[model samples]
Target chain A: MTVERSAPPTISEVAAEAGVGRATAARTLGGYGYVSPELRSRVLAAAERLGYRANALARSMSTGVSHTLGVIVADIGNPFFAGVVRGISDASRARGFDTIVLSTHESLDEEIAAMHVLIDKQVDGIVVASAALGPKTSAHIAEAWSRGIPVVLVDRAVPGLELDAVVIDNREAAREAVTALIAAGHRRVGFVWGPPIAGRPDRRRDLVDAAARNLWTDGERLRGYLDALDDAGLPFDADLVMVGEKTEERAIAEVERMLGLDDRVTALFCTETDAVTGALRAIRATGFRVPADVSLIGFDDSSWAAVMEPPLTMIEQPMLALGTRAAEVLLALIDGAPRSQPDGAFRHTLDTRLVERSSVAPPSA
Target chain B: MTVERSAPPTISEVAAEAGVGRATAARTLGGYGYVSPELRSRVLAAAERLGYRANALARSMSTGVSHTLGVIVADIGNPFFAGVVRGISDASRARGFDTIVLSTHESLDEEIAAMHVLIDKQVDGIVVASAALGPKTSAHIAEAWSRGIPVVLVDRAVPGLELDAVVIDNREAAREAVTALIAAGHRRVGFVWGPPIAGRPDRRRDLVDAAARNLWTDGERLRGYLDALDDAGLPFDADLVMVGEKTEERAIAEVERMLGLDDRVTALFCTETDAVTGALRAIRATGFRVPADVSLIGFDDSSWAAVMEPPLTMIEQPMLALGTRAAEVLLALIDGAPRSQPDGAFRHTLDTRLVERSSVAPPSA
Candidate 1:
């Protein structure tokens, strides 16, 4: 250590200066459990005198629980994830837990590495919006479970992993959103979404299974759209379903492709916030009006969506509830609750609401 | 611990199964140092057969370096902060480091607690967008330095603590922004911002010193605004400065208060993204047009600012650069680089530029 940098005053120094037992001094300074005001003040005064301060890391090593939760999200730049993180933080703090948040940026490899980092940090439990890691590539997650650390899934659940998950009913709500647009007399509607990973052919030709192999969320949303088309007695125009990368620029490109189709989409159903924003920019750039030129319904309501020229109609996922519930389940598991059968993981699916704003109207005849 | 849940097969089991020395098995399995392909594959196959996996915690205990960086920000919901975090994560990953990001939500206690949590986690270094902790309450920070962990400040520097900081020339940027509006012939302008703290007695006759105690970032911005007024020979009207909590609702309320001023301000200057958004909503709600009715300029350019009916002309902070630079500096310090003199800390001031779009005009003259 450098000579100019003297040692930081320790808990022992404060304890000795306050003339109290180490445990009492700790209770006074750590802000955990209980300590008498008189003792607290004495310890605080001594800490002030000797320059002793609270050291949470030291306490964690002794207590075995770091009082911190690790949260791994798909992306932090996305406002939807931001809302969920805020919800998690709000609930976590209320329950005396701090959160260590990491963004995977939608990479399975990054997600696995992040989980390892979180485990090293010794977070009590983890809540992740995973990258849909396949069973063959999921050793890190299984490792977490094997070590007795709880894990909760948010937004999307992996098919092979038996884990607690909190999610909104993506399929049903997506179908409802599309149905509403169909009811508004749109025969040609385009669905813009990210194609989940490929290579695993659905052995079971079931719609649910087909969707599950892709992103659990995207699959459900797609299934709902497909089911809505069937209910409306509309043909499943594969050309109208734009399955490509899930990025703002990619969404715009898909939209442009849909516009150039022989049966140009009269209505667009966007499945993410970035897609919606990008679609809006594309529509404006093409010299088209919102409802007047292209009716639209988007996913995940935002403050900006509300303030847009014509407020957007969106399927509002209960974002905060998803995060809070995930944390709740993970905490329960961490607090010694027995894990149910691997086939019977605790899964909570919240409902989403269609917020009807001015962005959608009857399609042109 | 349960009868049905057997203990995870340990490293020893894998080593024995692999028919290799413990150290060789460890190297092969841990992805550290060097191991031949044949040995690595053998060890991996044996570990797979035994359902054995590496534990990062065990590794961290031995190495004493978590290979993770802790970043504590004031607020994660703020887009400006979110951009900074994304930059930090990008830079961290590029250098084979992972970040454990924590949000203090502007609470000093939370920041301090977060610091302890990170320290306990054994992170290599820390980068903090500190809450500008008061001198009397900042021993926790000093303690970290005493323990030989480096901390780098972003956006604001603590006056009492000598630490490396990455910042923009907030005062100059503010003055230039305000000067632009002033030069546009707007004599009466509303300055909307969040008050530093609720109970701070700003009884000091000097405005420069008054703002410093609240937050370094806010104080510098405030000082710049005052300097602009002083330079332009305009009177400093305290009533024109709306100081309240920094939230959308509070901003709306403050804007309403400004509109109700005896000499209602002609134009508005917002100091944050939420404030800018709220001000826009308020203006729209009041049936006022941008530049035509109330010329406006906002701090922290945003995506929504571009999509607005009249694109906003505002100051753009190099948010990503701020995070990247701070992390880079801290990483340098962590690499055993000699510490510079405490009084001459490594200070980086990135430039802020005015992005002029269509939001500003000659005050309707």
Candidate 2:
């Protein structure tokens, strides 16, 4: 049999061939309303004969709803963010929402720009896991809100703005992790912190017996650490505390330096995944074994943590709950419910738990 | 000095204190609309006195465009998809779009549901990296198109559907990799393929034989492999050909079984990243060094491929370009431009190149 040789016809050509207006042809061929059955049949026949396909772009513009959801994340490479995004997708699909994802690369400007583009496209709702939330960003969101849009904040919280937010109890989780380490016969431990924000000031002070700088999550987590230490009757040592950036390389380097100092830390208390991964890698590279050469406790129970050589001991954040709760709250607000019930701030904080893994152990002599 | 202990003020309380209508006070304090100077000052004063924080959810429903983009991917854990997402985010942010991400988990039902929910929310456009596309899915997309929504397909393509799509030359890349093995003086070569799909009948034939199948990508790549064998004057061995699912463990097991057969293959061609990683691990586990015992070639030059103990020789796809092009095309189409010039099927194919690493070498006798 000879192969069929003919180009597919265009929508405009089909419209012209059928002697109908472009709009009529678009409506008829696209299977929409307001077209006479006779004219619609003619348009359909012409389209079939000419092999015309309707343009998706034009159709989307007229509909107003693109059947797409915009997801803004700090980074896709981070396994934690990846898991949360996965959870969001699963939940959204269950609710009939197609997703469009954008990564901010931890830039405030990029995050702001993404917001504008998604808004211009008129996305149904926005779910943001932002790294930095400045005053301008908050104002931009406020503008969208005034226009009757729905937004949910995931992972991180904006200080002043009141939006539907999903987050784990960072302070309580950190305190419990440190408390566990102390219970396991460890007194001296090092802490790693996140960005300095006004919402968490005590965490910074709890790092060392120093003045409290304006920091939120980090400070609260640090306070939990201190509370645990005080409860255990252990004196917090300034020399054992090191506060700076959070990453594997930086944490590893800091740990190495501290280990080489006159008074070395007996156990490690890492507040982030990066810090924990770095500490483990550093310990391995130095030919030291976990819980044998040094005991360790970490935050954020990521997937890789469990699969690591000596499975990590960490605080497990309720990731799926965070996404589901955020979606539910945002949907509720979209349905026009009062922000509060004449009681208190409409804030919900999910609890976190400590998971004992192979990484943590009794203090090494 | 006594620390101040008082409850925060409510929105209605602020409205009463400001002596303005509740709606006007809510609008002003919530930053939803334009307010008179005198009224704005009064509302601000009242809010400050009441310590009122505007609710994000309430504000969003009042706004039309939520300043969000919806992103859908198959699996976020897959580093390849993760990288593409990062590129989309980077480009989107540069253009000012906030992203909302969802994962379909390779389910068609989830894909359809996601589309519906996003539509209900009124998203501007959608970018989808679909798991698999069938006629029903295409029809659903056609419905969305009729409504004037823009969609950009990434990594995957649907036949007989007119939409903007971004894809790398998978077949050519696979063929080139196989050809390289032949050039390095390997006669007996084994093959590892991904899961077979029924919708792609031609692809199945290409996997079996080129003359009968004629799939654009798989056929071309299979032809490339046969071309190398033909040029080398090596007889095609049917027993050496093997097809298996795409997974590290499965690929490794298949390769091991193939190796156990009498007079087994001397070189291998892996068409997917998982298969390649599995083959590498199996080779290492078997105590056979790459290019020393049995030569190998991999498709898709992922980060881990380069960082592995012995760098992998593989095909490098233009991943970022694929996403950017898809976005640009969808945006153009949304702007009322024809899908293609001359009103016919528009197809664009990108070139793939082989990066020579240490993974390939002549077979050892």
Clashes of each: 0, 63
Candidates' chain B TM-scores in the order shown? 0.82, 0.74
Task: List runs of model 1 lying over 4 Å from the truth.
Answer: A1-63, A196-214, A340-342, B1-55, B58-62, B196-211, B344-346
Predicted chain B of candidate 2, TM-score versus the true chain B:
0.74
- Model-by-model lDDT, in order? 0.77, 0.64
The residue-by-residue lDDT of candidate 2 on A148-263, one tens digit each, is 55777787766556665677767678788888787888877766544322232344354433313323455567777778888898886655555454556667777786676676
lDDT of 2 by residue, B63-174 (tens): 3234444556667756667766666655655565455555667666667666655544445567777654444456556545644567777776655566666777565576
Each candidate's DockQ: 0.25, 0.16
TM-score of 2: 0.61
How far off is each candidate at the interface, as Cα RMSD in Å? 8.7, 9.9
Which one wins on lDDT?
1
